[model samples]
Target: MKKETRHRATIIDVAKRAGVSKSTVARVLGGSPNISEEAAERVHAAVSATGYEPNHLAVGMRSGRSGLLGLVIPDIANPFWADVARGAQDQAAKEGMSLLVFSSDWDSAKEAAHLRALRQARVDGAIINPVADNLDGLDRFGMPFVLIGSSAESFPDTSSVGSDIAQGVRLGMDVLLAHGHAQPAFILGPKSKLARARFLRAINQHCIERDIDPASLHTEDSDYTVEGGKEAMSRLLERASKGRHLAVFCANDLMALGAILAVRDAGLRCPEDVSILGFDGIPSGAFSWPALTTIEKDGRKIGSTTVTCLFDEMAGRPEHGRVYIPCRLIERGSLANLLAGNTDRLAAGR
Candidate 1:
């Protein structure tokens, strides 16, 4: 049997078929301003006829641009991160660039490896949601990068876009306190992370300003998962006494949902027994039994803004030091006013 040989089309073939010079074909394909309308039309027609595919790798090599961007996130399972990925992807497409996402699973070692891989792939730039507080070697990568949802202290010089975590936490606390919950507990993420540390610090500051004993505040660390939230809530319940209007402010909606579940599992009611407040306003929070009242942070906007900053840096634009997206309080069913003696306001509308 004879082996079949495949034929590949080239720019030379396109130029020959278009009855134009190779330089004219190159200009038309490269979107050069020197090309005439007629020449462009002829080049496109020849490309269709000859099925010529431009060698992007060769072009990128000569131009020193990969036209690719990287997004490093800690978790892909979380809906917040998923929304962020979508927003970044949308923005990337608008700029005629491609995005590659890497999930480090909140591991510092994996995060570092992913950064190394992105640099090796020669991506034009990157937006990273760092997993650790110390980003010591990030500058050595020599690629322009923007931090998203990471603490300001992590990468002081890099442009960053994130929700105002401290403000969000304070909002949640104020709401609970206004509703007459005096001793609100906190379900925190790992304190080692900057985001969590900021949250804890904000809670402490709020307590100090209110003349509440800082040592009286209860805090439990969790992994930011539903199960982790449930476990943290359960631990709090063990120390909680009955007849007290207890409230818990969770770091994120997932944990808040878990806390609600734990409350129910303990043969108690949400908002009636223990009010729950969450951050990150994820869609799932709305569908929960007692819809979560949360601090709404637009993850999509954060992602888009981070990418915009990264592209700006890539284009030699002046760095925007730190961009903080504001958070809004979305009142829902999960949080209730204990002093009002009516749970009507805690309806599932946000």
Candidate 2:
């Protein structure tokens, strides 16, 4: 067989076509600021014409900037976290940077290990959603980094991009209260400080705004899992004696779906026996039996924006700031207006 010939373009070809020195081409490729505007235009024109892509590894080695961002997430399997990762990944790629991810699995040891690895790799920056309560350990890390999703209020040294969960909770509660739910039940996540703090702040704020007693709102904390939601809901159903129609707001969608099942298991119907609202608009939540009413946290936006923030930080720009992505409420059939009859059924399972 004849030797296979590749048609890939090289930097020399671009340099020749642009009538610029190879050094100029290298500077342009490395995003060096010393290059002139006219030279950059010519190099860009040549690049577009030849479809030439620079070798990232070679460029990184020369510049001493790996152009690599290390992203550490608490739990990759959770749809909420998945959204965040996706956003960060897309943004990093858009900036011509690579993302190196490490799943902490909600384990502190694993998180610490990942941080050490990132530092060992000498990454340009990190975007970490810390697994531990305080990421004080990361302070010793010399690389630039941003915190995504979760924030430790006590530790304000790092930059972050996160959701306004308190706002999400407030919105969910407002919708429920407006629908005539006098007493609402909360399905919370694990004992993370941020989770607990968000719930407490939102509940207090909502109660004050609605002129309702804070003690009237019922709360149950569990792991950020479907089973946790189920167990927590079961306990709430037991306490929901005297035919009181409960409006339940879950911390996350998985828990909300679990609560929906628990409500059904308790010989009650959703939006009929109770109104259910969930957080994190995971796609599965929309396809659940009754279609879950949830707060849509734009994971795509969060992920992409976090990457942008990380890149900005890496550039030594004035970007040490916190970004809060607003939550949107998706109205589904799960929330029922106060009526004496039990009605509504889940859609066919996907």
Best by TM-score: 1
lDDT of 2 by residue, 32-115 (tens): 999999999999999999999887667677778877889889888888788787878888887877889889988889988898
Backbone clash count for every predicted candidate, in the order shown: 0, 6
**Residue 57 in candidate 1, Cα distance off native in Å:** 2.0
Model 1 spans with C-alpha error above 4 angstroms: 1-22, 45-53, 343-350
Predicted candidate 1 versus true structure: per-residue lDDT over 213-262, tens digit per residue: 97888989998899999999999999997656578999998999999999
Full-model lDDT for every candidate: 0.87, 0.82
The reply for model 2, stretches above 4 Å from the true place, is 1-55, 339-350
lDDT, candidate 2, residue 4?
A: 93
lDDT for model 2: 0.82
Which pairs clash inside model 1? none
RMSD to true structure for each model, in Å: 3.7, 5.1
